[model samples]
Target chain A: MMSKIVRTMASFLILFVLIYGLYIIMHGHSTPGGGFQGGAVVASGVALLIVAFGSHSIHRSLLERRLSILISIGLLIFIGLAFGGMAKTFFYNFLVGSPIFGHIPPSGPNPGEMSSGGVIPIMDIGVGLNVAGGLSAILLVMALATTVMEVEE
Target chain B: MRKIAIAVSLSIFIGFLIATAFLIHPFGYPPSEMDDYIIENTQSETGANNAVTAVIFDYRGFDTLGEATILFTAVTGVVMLFRAKKKREK
Candidate 1:
């Protein structure tokens, strides 16, 4: 466990970290960051919590099984979206002209739109989920392993 | 003789690196024929303002899929390695 000050600070800071990460993920199609980067950001927050509270306490709520399931769900969403465009060709932007997320920006420089980018935004969310879950699970397991070693010692 | 050979090889490798660095394209001006096409058509075709995202998720999605798979495999390996010991102890 960390000092009380660190724990308190981490708890307070995780909310902003989560929101910023989600913003990056959601605006991936218009911004600089995307799924992997945003997901890494979210995982860093989890790392902060792990460092503050120790793995055992975090593990009680965020189990490896749950994380694994989250990873699976993300993979499924991503692959399903990919397959959805298979009729045209794999990874086709099938939603380009559709009513959903189908607004095309001007040819030149302009401000971006949220409901644009067809399947890109959805794929961003999926990859973000997968990356967040996978990274957090790895960190938690490693922390738990180290704790076990310390106990043994 | 061995020391001379190692020095010669190291210098040769360093020289090759320098030569390649000088010969490489100037920054931000890659010699890709597809760049113009992607830039011109990305907004209309993919409906995305960010060309990079359109390329990754739409044009070259297989790479992302493979990357996700690699991450999944890594997590599985890590969990399996540690979970077995924990189960045995309990």
Candidate 2:
């Protein structure tokens, strides 16, 4: 119906927003934003999407359950990466020329580029995912509770 | 009812803004120049080139741990507030 058209348009707009948000988050590591700022921007975009389109319209697409799982998974990955590094050389730049399991050297720039160098990029990705997942979990749980509240009345 | 709820929440949010304003000094503490040392050493020892990470996790570890505790508490509060909704629905 007409409502579906409106929702579909809104959905497309939200998708645009989310992509832009990711771009911002990715560049954020090197620029003004770090994990917290970039994460929050991406999270807010998700929240705005929820507001514009009903959960049923987008919930499955967002993978509510998987996102919750990913939240913990990201945390574990980050912590494991951290502690694992600690055990080796007391938190050595294990990600750098880390050789991807001691085989391949790190990404280019001859290992001299600070921003382009090792482990930092990996850490940024992990933090970005963690923020996105964590924020989504908060929204999911809140939404679940709110839906229940409506049912109770 | 929705309007009242919105108003109340807004007030609470505004109140927090006000409360925090007075908690810290406007003219902040002296520049410790402490971060400079951490930044230099972190590159060699910690291997973390990111200055913020070196300062937050390695140099000021105790504060970072405290922040983690704060995040835990905030999440716990949200869960508790919403917990009753599930039972009420059933």
Candidate 3:
């Protein structure tokens, strides 16, 4: 078992990391960070938690099965969004200037628009989910395998 | 003779590194006309304030798709490799 202080610090840090990552992903189309960076940050937070608490506790709480599902869902959302713009092109920017996420700004550096960038935000979300699940699964699988190997020995 | 050979190889490596450094363009001034075009047209085209994101998710979406495919494959491979452990645990 880990120390109480270590666990408490990890718990506190994880929340901030998650929120920052989500912010990066959400503001991807209007800021510096994008899906990959945000997802990596969030996955690192998960890694920190796992390291603090050990893999077994994490394994019981967050199943690999669920992560696989998340990866699949994220990929499906991306592909579906791509197909959504098939009427014009495969991955068309059809949503730009429409109601949804299609608010065109005045063609200069402005305040920022949440509902702009059309399909970019959706793609960012999909990619972010895919990366987070994939990376966390990799880390968990490695941890779980090592524990199993030790048990065998 | 061994020491001489190591010295020669190290000098050659250093020479190559120096040559590469000399060949590289000065910092902050990349000769990219495409960048100027993208910066100019990104707002109207994609409507996203961040041109980088616009390029990643819109202009070059195929690239993102390829990246997603690579991640999916990696995760699948890892899970498959560890499936035996899961079965054993069960």
DockQ score of each predicted structure, in the order shown = 0.79, 0.15, 0.70
lDDT of 1 by residue, A80-149 (tens): 9999998889888788888866877777677634438889999999999999999999999999999998
Model 1: lDDT equals: 0.92
Query: What i-RMS does each candidate reach, in Å?
Result: 1.1, 5.9, 1.1
lDDT of candidate 3 over B1-90, digit per residue (tens): 999999999999999999988899887888989989999999899988898898888888999999999999999999898997678778
Choose 1 or 2, whichever is better by TM-score.
Answer: 1
The candidate, 1 or 3, that scores higher on lDDT is 1
Q: What is the Å distance of residue A17 in model 1 from its true position?
A: 0.7
Estimate the Cα RMSD of every predicted model relative to the unseen true structure.
2.1, 8.0, 3.0
For each candidate, what is the lDDT?
A: 0.92, 0.57, 0.90
lDDT (10s digit) by residue, model 1, range B1-90: 999999999999999999999999988788987988898888888888889988889888999999999999999999999989889988
What TM-score against the true fold does each predicted structure earn? 0.92, 0.62, 0.87
Q: Write the per-residue lDDT of candidate 3 for residues A29-109, one digit (tens) a residue.
A: 887999999999999998998899999999998988999898998899899999999999999988997886677888786
Return the candidate ranking by TM-score, descending: 1, 3, 2
Instruction: Point out where model 1 deviates above 4 Å.
Output: A112-115, B1-11, B88-90
Best-fitting candidate, scored by TM-score: 1
Specify the poorest-scoring 10-residue window by lDDT in model 3 chain B: B81-90
